[model samples]
Target chain A: MDILQALANGFEVALQPVNLLLVFVGCLVGTLIGVLPGIGPISGVALLVPLTFALKLTPESAIILLAGIYYGAMYGGSTTSILLNIPGETSSVVTTLDGNQMARQGRAGAALAISAWGSFIAGTLSVLALMLLGPLLAQWAIRFGPAEYFALMVFGFSTLSALAGKNMAKALLATLFGLLLSTVGQDPQSGMSRFTFGLLQLEDGMDFLVVAIGLFAVSEVLMILQDKAPPAVQATVGRVYLSLKEFTFSLLTILRSSILGFVIGVLPGAGASIASFVAYTVEKRLLGSRARFGQGDIRGVAAPESANNAAAGGAMIPLLTLGLPGSGTTAIMLGALVSLGVTPGPQMFQQHPNVVWGLIASMYVGNAMLLLLNLPLVGLFVRLLAVPSWFLIPAVLAVSFIGVYAVNNNPFDLLLMTVFGLVGYVMRRLDFPLAPVLLGLVLGYLMEVNLRRAMAISNGDVGFLFSSPIAIVLWVLAGLSLFAPTLLSRFVKRGALGDDEI
Target chain B: MSNPTHRTDRIVGVLLLLLSIAYGWTASRFEVGMLSDPVGPKPFPYLIAICTAVASLWLILRPDPDPQWPPVSFWLPLGLVLGSLVAYAYLLVPLGFIVVTTLEMALLAVLFGARWWQGLAAGLAFSLVVYFLFTAGLNVPLPAGKIWGLGR
Candidate 1:
C-alpha cells in the first residue's frame, strides 16, 4: 500500500472515538507524570502498560496510548526543568540549564511557550521522517538473516553500554545481569529449564512489566523518599505567548537541533539526553563566544526542547523497523508491543499495518494535543509541582502496585518487583546505568534465539556469522561503537598535545 | 579517610565476582544434550557469566576514585520505604489489596516525612480510589481481605 493510503487507513483507526479518547488521556497522564519530578517517560510508560492491558484495547489503540505517553512525557519534562530546575529525567537535564534560568528571569512563559512550539514542530517533523524512513528500513531489514539480526542486536547492546553512562564496566555488568535474568526460564529450543529454581512463576521468566515497574517506578518512589521535599516553583509565570520576533529568531536553531536530534535519536543508545546536549552544544558552538547559553537564552530552551522531542520520534524508527529499542523508554514500549502480541521488526509493516500506521497517525495527533494542552495549560501544569511529594510518592507507588498485581493477579510478580526495585535502587546508588539492563533484558532472548538459529542453519560452523556482508558490517559497527568513546578521547588528547607543541 | 566512597566500588566488585562464580557454576549445571545443537542455552549464560566476571575484576582492580555514596540520613528512610514495599508484596494477597495497600501507602508517606494523620488520610483516599479504579473500571479482580471483605 502507498504511504498516503496507509496513513488514511491509520487515521480511520486513530480517529475512532475510543482511540482518540485514549490519545487524549495518554497525553494528559503523560504530561502529569512528566511534570512530576522523578517520574520519567520510562516509568510513565511502564506504569501505564498494565493499565492498557486491563483496558483491553486493541493492539493499535494500546500502543497509541503508550506511545502517546512516551512523547507526551518528553513535552511535559521541560515544564518542571524550566520551572523548578529539576529535570524529570536525564533527557530534560539540558533543558534545566536554560529553562530554569528563563523562569528566574521572569520569561518563564516565553520559555515554556517556545519549548512547546519547538517540540511540536520538531516532533511533527521527525514523524514525517519516521513515516518516510521507517518503512524503507523495515523493507531493507527483511533481507537480514539470523546472523545479521544477532549482529544488529549486539550492536544495540554495545552502543547502549558504551553510552549508557560514564562507567563502561558498570554498564557492561548491568547488561550482563539483564542477560542473566532473561535466561531464567525454560529454554525455548529445548524445553529444558535453565534457571527457574523450581518455582511455577519462574517457568515463564520475569515479566518485562514487573522488572520495569520495579526498576523504574518502584525505584523512583524509593529515591523520591530519600529527598526531604520537592523543589519549589516560581508562582508567577510571566506570559504564555512568545513574541513574533523571538519565534523567528529561534527558527533556525529549532530546525538545526531537530535534525541533529533526529539523527542522534536514530543511533542506538544515544537518546534524547544526548540529542539535547549535542544540539545545545552545537548551537553554542555556532554562536561561538557570543553565546549567552546558560543565562536564560531562549535559543537554549528551544534547541534542547526541539531536539529531545525530535529524538523521541527518531528513537521510535529503529524500534518500529528493526525491533531494536535504543533506550529504556523505547525498551518499555517494545515490551508493551511484545505483550500485545505484535512483533515489531522488518515484517511489522506487512504483518501489522494498522498498528504501525495508527501509531504514526497518533503521534501527529498526540503532538498537536500536547501543544494545545501545554500552551494554555502551562499554569495548571506548573501548579502540579506544588502537590506534596509525600502524597504523590505513595500515590505513584500504589498505582504501580495495583498495576503490577493487575497483570496476572500474581503475588510472586510483586515480590519479584520488590527484589528488582531494591536492586535498581542499589544500582542507582552505585551509579550503574539502568537503561542498558532493560535493553539487555529486552534483547537477550532474541539475541540468544538468533545466535542459536544462525548456528543451526550454518551446521555448527561459526564462520557463517561472518559470511553475510550485513552481519559483518553490523559486527564492525558494534565493535566501532564499543571503542568509539575511548578512541575519541585519545584523539582529543592527541589534539591537545599538538596544540601545546604549537 | 581517603575518599570513603572508594571503598564501595571495591566492596561491590568483590560481591559481583562472587556472584559471577556462582552464576557460572549454576549455568554449567543446566541440562544440555550431548548431540543437541551446537549453541545451546548454556552458551549464552556462560558468556554472560564470563563478561560479568571480567567486568567485576576490572571494577575491583581500578575502582573509581570518586564514588558519591548517599549521606547517612538517606538509609533510614530508604530502609523504611523498602521494607514497606516488601511487606506490601507479602501482605497484598492475604490482607487484601485495599487493606494492605492503604497501610503500605500510609507507611511510605510517613517515611517520606508526612504527618501520621495526613499520611493515613492520603493513603486511605489514594488506595481506595485505586482499588475502585482497577477493580470496577478495569475488571481486575483485586482481592478482598478474608478478614474484612473490603475489596472484591
Candidate 2:
C-alpha cells in the first residue's frame, strides 16, 4: 500500500475513542513527566510500560500511547530548561542558554509559546518526512540477511558505545556488562544456562522493565538526593501567545533546525541531544552578531526545541526500519514491542501495517494534542514544578514499586530491581552512560542470535561477518562509529555535549 | 561533591576486570547437551568477556580527571532509602502490599524531612488508592499480606 493509503487505515485505528484517550493521556502524562524535575522521557516511559499492560492495550494502541510519551516529552523537556535553567533531559541542555535568559527578561511566555509552536511544526513536519522516508528505507532494508543483520547490530552497538558517554571505554564496559547479564537465562539455541547462579528466579533472565525502571527511575530518585534543592520557580507565565514578529523571526530557524535535527537523528549514534546542541551552535555561528544568539534570542529558543523534537522523530526511523534504536527512549520502546511479540523491522510494515501506521498516524494527532495542551495549560504544568520533592518522591517510589509488582506479582523481581537501582546509581555517579546498558540488555539476545545464525551459515567462519556488501558496509560504519566521539568532540567542545547521553 | 582527582575509576576498572574473569570462568564451565548452532553459546560469551576485560584495562589506564563523587551527607540517607526498598521487597508478601508499602513510603518521605504523621497519612492514602486501582481497575491482584490479611 501507498503511504497515504496506509495512513488512512492508521487513522481508522488511531481515531478510536479508547486509542484517542490513550494518546491524550500519554501526551499529558508524558508532558507532566517531562516537566517534573526528577524523571526524563526514558524513565517516564519505562516506569509506565506496566501501566499500559494494566490497561490491556493491543500492541498498536500500546505503541501509540508510548510514542505519544516519547515525543510529548520533547515538548515538555524544554519548559524546565527555559524556566528554571535546569534541563529535564539532555536534549534540552542547549535550551538553557537562551531560554532561561528569555524567561529572566520576562519573555518566558513568548519562549514557551515559541517552543510549543516550533515543536508542533517541526515535529509534525518530521512525521511527514517519516511518512515518506520510512517506506523507502524499509524497502532497502528488506534485503538484510543474517550476516547483514549481525553487522548492523555491530554498527548499532558501536554507534551507541562511542557517543553514549564521554569515555568510550566506560560505555563499552556498560554494554559488555549488559550483554553478560542478558546471558544469564537459558541459551536460546542450546538450552544451556549461562549465569543463573543456581537461582530458579533468574532462569528466564532479567526482565528489562525491572532493570529499566531500576536504572532510570530508582537511580534518578537517588540522584535527586544529591541535589541540595531545586531552584525556586520564579518565572511567571505572563502570556503564552507569541507576537507575529517573533514568529516571523524564528521561522527560518525552526525550518533549519528541524531539517538538521532530523538528519542527525537518522544517524545511529547521533541522538536528540546532539541535534539540539549542534543546532544551537550552528544557529549562533550562522547568525553571529546579527541576532543576540544566546542572551534572550527567541531564535535560540526555537532552534534547539525544534531540533530536539525533530530529532526524536528522526531517531524513530532507524528503530522502525532496521530494528536499531538510536536513542534510549527508542531502545525501551523496541524492548516493549519485542515483549509484546511485535518485532520491528522492514517486515513490520508488511506484517503489522495497522500497528505501524496507527503509531505513525497517532504521532500527528499527538503532536496536535500537545500543542493544544502545552499552549494554554503551560501554566498548569509549570505549577507542577512547585510540588515539594518529598511529596513527589513517595508518590514516584510507590508507583514504581506497585507498577513492578503488579506486572509479575513476584517479590524476587523487586529485590532484583533494587540491585539494579544500586548499580544504576553507581553508574550515574561515575558518569557511565546508562543508555548503552539498557540498549545492550535489550539487543543482546538478538545480537547473539544473529551472530550464531551467521556463523552457522558460514560454517563458523568469522570472515562471514564481512562477506556481504551490506554487511561489509555496516562493519565499516561500525569501525567509524567507534571513533565518532573523539572526532565529534574535536569540533564541539566536550562541555557542549552534556554528560547525559540520552 | 566533586573530585578533581579520583581513583574511583581505577577501583571500578579492577572490579570490572574481576567480573570479566569470573564471567569467563563460568562460561567455560557451561555444559551444553547439544549445539544447535556452530558458534554455540560459548563463543559469544567469550567475546563479551574479552571486551569487558579490554574495556576495564583501558579505563584503568586512562581514567577521567574529574569524576564527581556523591556527597558525604547524602550517603547516610541514600543507604537508608536503599535499605528500606530492599526491606520492602522482602516484606511486601508477608506484611501485604498495603501495610508494607505504607510503612515504606512513610519512612522514605520522613527520612527526607516530611513530618512523621504527614508521611504516614500520605503513605496510607497513596497505598489504598493504588491497591484499588490495581485490583479493581486493572484486574491485577496484589498481595494483601500473609500475616494480617489487610487487603484482598
Candidate 3:
C-alpha cells in the first residue's frame, strides 16, 4: 500500500477511543517527567513500561503510548531549559543558551510560547516526512541478508568510535567496554558460560533495564547529591500565549530548523544534540547584526527547540526501517520493541503496520496535545519543582527499583542495578559516554549471531562479507565517519569565526 | 599529580582490558563450534578483547589530560547501600515484609545523607506506608518473617 493509505489506516487505529486516551495520558505523564529536573523520556518510559504490562494492552497500543511519551517529553524538556538553565536532556542544552536568557530578560512567557509553537511546527512537519519516508525505507531494507544486517550493526558501532568521545581512541575504548559488558551472560551460540564467575544470576546475562536505570537514573541521583541545591530560577511569567508579531518572527526560524534537524537526524549517530547545535548556528548566521542570539533572542529559543523535536522524529526512521538507532534514547526504544517480540526492520511494516502507523499517527496527536496542555498547565507542571527533593528522589528511586523487581520478583536484579549504578557514576566522572554502552548491550548479541550465521552460510569464505556491494559501501562510509570529527574541527578552526561563535 | 585524571583512566582502561581477556578466556572454555563460517559466538567477544587491548595500550601510552576525581569519602555510602540490598535479598524471603523493609529503608535513608534522627523516623514511616500499600491495599503476598502469627 502507498504511504497515504497506510497513514489513513493508522489514523483509524490511533483515533480509537482507548488508543487516543493512552496517547493523551502518555503525553501528560511525559511532560510532567520532562519538566522535573534530571528525568528524561527514558526514565518516564521505563517507569511506565511495567504499568503497560499490568494493563495487558496490545503491542501496538503499548508502542503508541511509549512513543508518545518519548516525543512529548522532548517538548516538555524545553520548558525547564527556557525557565531555568537546567536541561532535562542533553538535547535541550542548546535551548538553554538563549532560552534562559529570554526568561531572565522578562520575556520568559514569550520564550516558552515560542518553544512550544516551534516544537509543534517541527513535530507536525516531521511526522509528515515520516509518513512519506518510512514506507520507502522499509521496502528498500526488505532485500537485506544477514550479512547486510551485520554490516549495518558494525556501521552503528563505528559511529561511537567516530563521534562518542574526545578522540577516536577513547571512543573505541568505550565501545570495547560496552561490547565486553554485552558478553556478561550465557553465550547465545555456544551456550557456554562467560564472565559470569559461577553466579547463577549471571546465566541469563545483564538485564538492559538494570544497566539503563542504574546508569541513567540512579547515577544521575548520585550526581545530584554532589551538588548542594539545584540552581535557583525565578520566572515572572507574563502573556502565556504568543502575540501575532512574535508568531510571525518565530515561524520562519522554526521552519528552517525543522528541515535542518530532520536532515541531520536521518543520518545515523547525528541526533538531537548536533541538530540543535546546527540550528543555533544557522539561526545566528541568519540573524547576523540583529543577533541577540547568546542573549534573549526569541529565535534562539525557537531554533533548537524545533530542531530537536524534528530530529527525534528523524531518529525513528532508521530505528523503524533499518533497525538502526541514531541516539541513546532510540536505542532503548529499540530494546523495548525487541522485548515486546517485534523485530523493527522492514518486515515490521508488513507484519505490524498497525504498530508502525499508530506510532506515527500518535506523534501528530501527541504534539498537538503537548502544545495545548503546556500552555495553560505550565504553572501546574512547574509546581512539581517545589516538592522537596527528599521525598521526590527517594520515591522516584524506590519506584524505579520496584519496576525492576516487578519484572522477575528477583532481588538479584536490584543488586546488579546498584553495581551498574556505581560503575556508571565512575564512568561519568571520567567523561565516558553512557550511550555506547547501551547500544553495545542491545546490539552486541544480534551482531554476533548474524555475523556467525552469515559466515556459516558462506562456508568460511572471507570474501562473502565484502561481496555484497551494500556491505562494502557501508564499511567505506564507516571508515570515513571515523575521520569526520577531526576534519570538521580543522575546517571550523580555519574559518573566520572562532570556536566561541560557532 | 601532573595528570592526576589520566592515572585513573589508565588504571581503569587496564582493568577493563584484563576483564576482556578474562571474558575471552571464558569464551574459549566453551567448545567453539564453527558453523562453517569465519564468525561464530566467540568471534564477537574475541573482537571486543582485541579492541579493548589496543585501546588500553593507547590510553596508557597517550593518556588524555587528567582532571580531579571524587574522593573515596563519597564511596562510604556505597557500602551501606550494598549492605542494605544484600540483606533485602536474603531476608525478604524469611523475615516478614514489615521488618525487612523497615530496616532496609532506615539504613538507606541514613546513607542518603539524612540526619540519623530524621532518617530513622522517615524511614520507618515510609516503610510502613509501602507495606500497607503493597500488602493491604494491593493484596499481593509479601514475605512473612519468623513471627508468622503476628504478620498473618
Clashing pairs in 1: none
* Candidate 1 residue-wise lDDT, A1-502, digit = tens: 6999999988998999999999999999888877888787888898888888887878999999988888888889888888888887677899999889988988889999999999999999999999999999999999998999998988888888777777778888888888888988888888788788899898988888899889988887777766565655556776788999999999999999999999989988888988988899889879877769999899999999999999999999999999999899899888888988998899999999999999999999999999988899978888878888888888888888877887778888888998889999888888898988888888889989999999999998989989988989999988987777666766678444322211
Residues A1-502 of candidate 3: C-alpha lDDT, one tens digit per residue: 5777988998898999999999999888888777877676666777667666556678788888888887878888888888778887777889999999988888889988998899899999999998898888889889988888888887877875666645566667766776787888887766767788889988888877777887777777777656533744555566777799999988889999999989878776667877888899888988899878888888998999999899989989998998887777788778777878887889989999998998998888888888889888887777677665555566676667666665566678777777777777777787777777877887877877777888888986767778889989888777777666556767676343222322
Better of 2 and 3 by lDDT: 2
- DockQ list for all candidates: 0.68, 0.73, 0.43
Off by over 4 Å in 3: A231-235, A487-502, B1-5, B33-39, B71-73, B86-88, B95-152
Displacement of the residue B6 alpha carbon in candidate 2, Å = 4.7
After superposition on all C-alphas, the RMSD of every candidate to the true structure, in Å, is 2.8, 2.6, 3.2
DockQ of 1: 0.68
Q: Residue by residue across B17-69, what tens digits does model 1's lDDT show?
A: 99989989998987677635778778888888898999999888767765566
Relative to the true structure, candidate 3 reaches a TM of 0.91
lDDT of each: 0.86, 0.86, 0.77
Pairs in steric clash, model 2: B96-B145
Candidate numbers, best DockQ first, in rank order: 2, 1, 3
Given candidate 3, what's the lDDT at residue B99?
Answer: 68
